[model samples]
Target: MMDARHDHPKLVLPPPTYPAVLFVMAWVLDQHLIPPFIDSVSSAPLLGAILVILGLGAAGWAVLRFMRAGTHVEPHKPTLAMVMDGPFRFSRNPIYASFFALFAGVGMIMKLEWTIVFLPILWLCLRLWVIAPEEAFLSSRFGSEYEHYRQKVRRWL
Candidate 1:
């Protein structure tokens, strides 16, 4: 029988402890903090609901465009090229931005104020854990070309 073990170092598991902490915090706030705040402004009319739906649709479209841009290249692997055109021109991390928009829009539509709290947390996590490391890897890989694209594009719009 062939052995499965390899000589190469295994990939380090990024600590998801923080996300769990944030999830707990969100739950607590949802139970306590948001309800009272929402009581004052929970009545979103039909037009407002429609607008939220449209915004979510737009965000979904952006996500699809980002996926189809052939920029991802590798799944769960750092991007090889700095994708600066298409939706990326507006937001360097359109996939992450789409997630933010989708979550925020749903929160607004549902009057679940606590869900909006996840938006910034998600952005911060992506910035610290995902974007920064990816930036370092790409900068090292592509050098000046990547830097030029970074200079032109905002990290998030």
Candidate 2:
């Protein structure tokens, strides 16, 4: 059998690991070093909860589409098909976008200014380390189809 690693995208780390690390680091930094900057908004928690729910919904929709397409949801596995329905129709990287939303929401909820401040870094990491390699793999695997999709859809909305 072919080596499983060879079948997957060349990735620096698992896709979810980036956000997970960001979340923890943001929390730790907030607890130990960084102080909250944004003034307490009375509605912050409600807005944060809404964002979290929306992020979860979007991610769930994307995962469901992948399941229906018979494609592996994990980035470390080879994709069986290109999913273009549901949230994919809007953003090519909906799940990653959802991660950003989740990060923002959690930051707001926990009053972690570090999380909000470091969002750009999270985005950069996803764009370069995660999404870039995944796109490369998809472009190679699906060729014209992926290229067309890339042209049609924004990477993130």
Candidate 3:
């Protein structure tokens, strides 16, 4: 058997731990990035709260699955198993999606008017900086198994 650790794929991007910091910084700066003319929050208060609840719930669900499977949660490490249960069943990138929901939720909760633009930027960063590289790593390491999972689940819900 080919041990996963014996031939770990060469990761092209830096580990995601630092990007999380960048995300937080960007999250704060996002409020300032919006054009004064365009800054506006959604009128619906309940929707924001709901998004927060759902995002947190999904993140917790993914984390629980990861813990139960005994896989490393760090992006720098290669996961030993492909998880297909819990929130993962609904979205391949549940964590990222949850992050998005959380960001949007925070915006909604704070009524950060700039989030209309901020959310898309966050999504773009996560997709390009995080998800794309992650997908490539999974493909290189897991081969057809990852591909099969990719086919089975949407990258995001």
State which candidate has the highest lDDT. Answer: 2
RMSD of each: 6.3, 1.8, 3.6
Considering summed lDDT, which 10 consecutive residues are worst modelled in model 3? 35-44
lDDT of 1 by residue, 97-123 (tens): 655555555555556566556767866
TM per candidate comes to: 0.63, 0.93, 0.76
Give every collision pair in model 3: none
lDDT (Cα, tens digit) per residue for candidate 2, span 1-157:
3356666688989888988898899989988886776556867777888889999999999999999999999987877789999999999999999998899998888877788878999999998999889988889788899999999999998
Candidate with best TM-score: 2
**Order of the predicted models by lDDT, top scorer first:** 2, 3, 1
- 2 against 3, candidate with superior TM-score: 2
- Model 3 alpha-carbon miss at residue 100, Å: 1.1
Q: What overall lDDT goes with each candidate model?
A: 0.58, 0.87, 0.71
Worst 10 residues of 1 by lDDT: 1-10
Model 2, residue 12: distance off in Å is: 1.2
**Model 3, residue 106: what's the lDDT?**
65
When summed lDDT is taken over every stretch of 10 residues in candidate 2, the lowest stretch is 1-10
Which sequence of candidate numbers ranks them by TM-score, best first? Answer: 2, 3, 1
Q: What tens-digit string does per-residue lDDT give for candidate 3 at 1-157?
A: 5565643334445444433554465557655664333235345456778998998899888989999998866666657777889988889988888887776676667665455556677677777777877788778778898899899999998
Better of 1 and 2 by TM-score: 2
